[model samples]
Target: MSTDGRSASDSTTASALESASFVRLVTKADGDGLAASGLVARALAARGTPFQVTVGRTVATRTERAQATTGGDGDLTLVVGSTDATNATRLDTDDRPATLAAVDHVRDLGETPDLVLALAGLVAAGVEPGAGESEWLIETARERGLVERRPGVAIPTADPVDGLAHSTRVSAPWSGDVDATHETLSDAIGADLEAETDRADDADASGTTLEHTDHRALGSVVALDAVSAEAATAAAAESIQRVLKPYATPDAPFETVGGYADVLEATAQTEPGTGAALAMGHDAREPALAVWREYGRRAHNALEAASTGRYDGLFVVGIDDGPVEAVAALSTAFRSPEPLVLAVGAGEAALATREGTLPPLEGVARDLESVLEGTGDATDQGVTYDVTASGRRGYLQYDPAVDETTIIETVREYQ
Candidate 1:
């Protein structure tokens, strides 16, 4: 084994997949998981390997493990990006299959262990990248126009109106309020906001979209709004402008990879099956986009109505009913100095922190698991815990039996 937990060399190849009668691919329901699993499924198909994709929380349960192995002999189960899984062909750092051992090497080189890197490893293993192929997933995505390297605002869509209205990043007070959105846009862009919208509409009608200059102009106004917001910190506002790699394509469901990730994440918030279908490259784009838009509205509205209490190192926002993941993610656009803990009644809560925060959330979540009588795992710089004691077995779900006050106190203690 090499430093950073990867084997120094790999001998695994497509032969492992080719010999299998069937392949079951399993991964988390989040964006990276979906993208990685989908790419793997595509590669498996290209190799004539029959495969089915399954998505779940970060950790695979005992039942999931059992089902993963239920296929007849000669069938293979491939698990990707799960924290703790067994009885399968593990492609993550834990078991360090040669197929993905390079993931650690890439990590050691300071790159993310994302879908593209996963594909790069697979490509090295003689797996074809499907028709119209390239050796690397990034190259393939670029060749197919699945992603463009143009830098722009982090908003997934080009339309300033829709971007502002549905954006979780800017955390504009007008979120989910169309009139408020229009008013804010008018304030930032002057009467030009209406003219720009009309022009964009005309462009859409003419099969020509707005220019990059127009996007940058609108993005500038958004940057100003974020910097000027009282709730925003300098660091957070800086992060907003820093995320310039706007990944999008007209052929894809959402405007950008960020956008697609948003929609997939929101869909997974309540409907894992729907999220998994979209993630596995199934033709579920329209319904998934619809789910994201609706989820955005509810989550933003919840953020607006939340009863916020600021602590030394945490901000507790209590909401009635909304997607906990959405609430946590959207609220981060404002860039609070402290991590945000959002609670839904006493039955559900999530802790969301900006990436690279202190007291790494995995440790924090493990600590809270004991106190909350719950099981939790770190996903996207934060943790989602379900209070198993309450008999709930879903993401962001805790037990009302734990009570609201105790949850708050426990979080406070851990924070």
Candidate 2:
């Protein structure tokens, strides 16, 4: 019979039986039992047999309840759980001498199972089957014409101390010297037993050799124990400044390209210039100074060199009305080797202006300072500046620097 409790009509029956879903018996999350359950599921799948497998902590009262519910419809149910003999015995609800006796109760309920696969440890731990019980199980199998014994197949052997082993040398029963029937039953059971054995071995191997590694190593950057956040920040800042210095010039022009006005505003806060720094509104505008600083730093090295001397010509041209002009200004200002900044301040006109030539760095820087000081609004915004020197280009990005309390206050306000 196949695992679905149907008679075999072809050689494939054995395969079908092997693949049919069966109840998995496990004990305490035993790896062996889990693997065995998987093997059983795979075997059923291979044979195109319909089956369902359930897993649980132990073959206890809960498992029995599940089995009663799921097994009545002739569906195979495998329970995997802890395999302690005492625990198994306590869980058995059947009157038979051992936990395997539950098999008979299931069959008696008009559902004859194709097989009963008990994990070795579970069987070893359960109550021993008495002689009467053994004979009764075999007789039931014979009367039902289900093979109880087959030659050349290694049936589960009980340790001498095991009650079931002493009671029965189990075998599949079939009538009339039917070689095919014997072969079918033997092959089916043998495959299942072998798979279980293999799984158990694999579990043992894994337990013995497995090693654990940090999961974060898969993607995160590792830092040395000695590294501190402040130190790292300083290092990064130093590197950026070094890169920026080469492209710096004393007198660079600020172009009216690429929203150069904003760049000018940013530079005014950070970059020193010949002219008095322009003041911005201190109320809501103070927070935005960081943005201006970033823009200045980034475009600082790209300023176009203008007139030299203590009157270094660094200019910042703001496109308060024309966008095209702003972009062009920014582009030109950024191409210089001095601090030429630009600020394309808020307004539609600024965005509409056409591109224009860059001015000197001193003029750009001066204008930047003017705009930053001129606008009193302090809002946090990101600003970007690009610098190129000796064919190498880099970016300087800035965000408003604030303390934890200020950030928390901002977040709470938003919330």
Best by TM-score: 1
lDDT of 1 by residue, 1-415 (tens): 2344433332242335556788877665444445556555655555566888776654534226535468688787766554444467655443332334434323333444344324423322223333122234556567766557555554445455655566554565566765676666666545344434322533221111234235555566666666777666655575565444455555665565555556655665556667767655678865665566677778878877777777776666777877765565555546456654444454566655554332333444565556654434323333343211111112444445555565667566644
Q: After superposition, how far is residue 384 of candidate 2 from its true place, in Å?
A: 58
Return the top candidate by lDDT.
Answer: 1
242, model 1: CA deviation in Å? 4.1
Model 2, stretches more than 4 Å misplaced?
1-51, 57-91, 94-101, 115-132, 141-415
Candidate 2: TM-score?
A: 0.18
- What TM-scores do the predictions have? 0.71, 0.18
lDDT, candidate 1, residue 17?
55
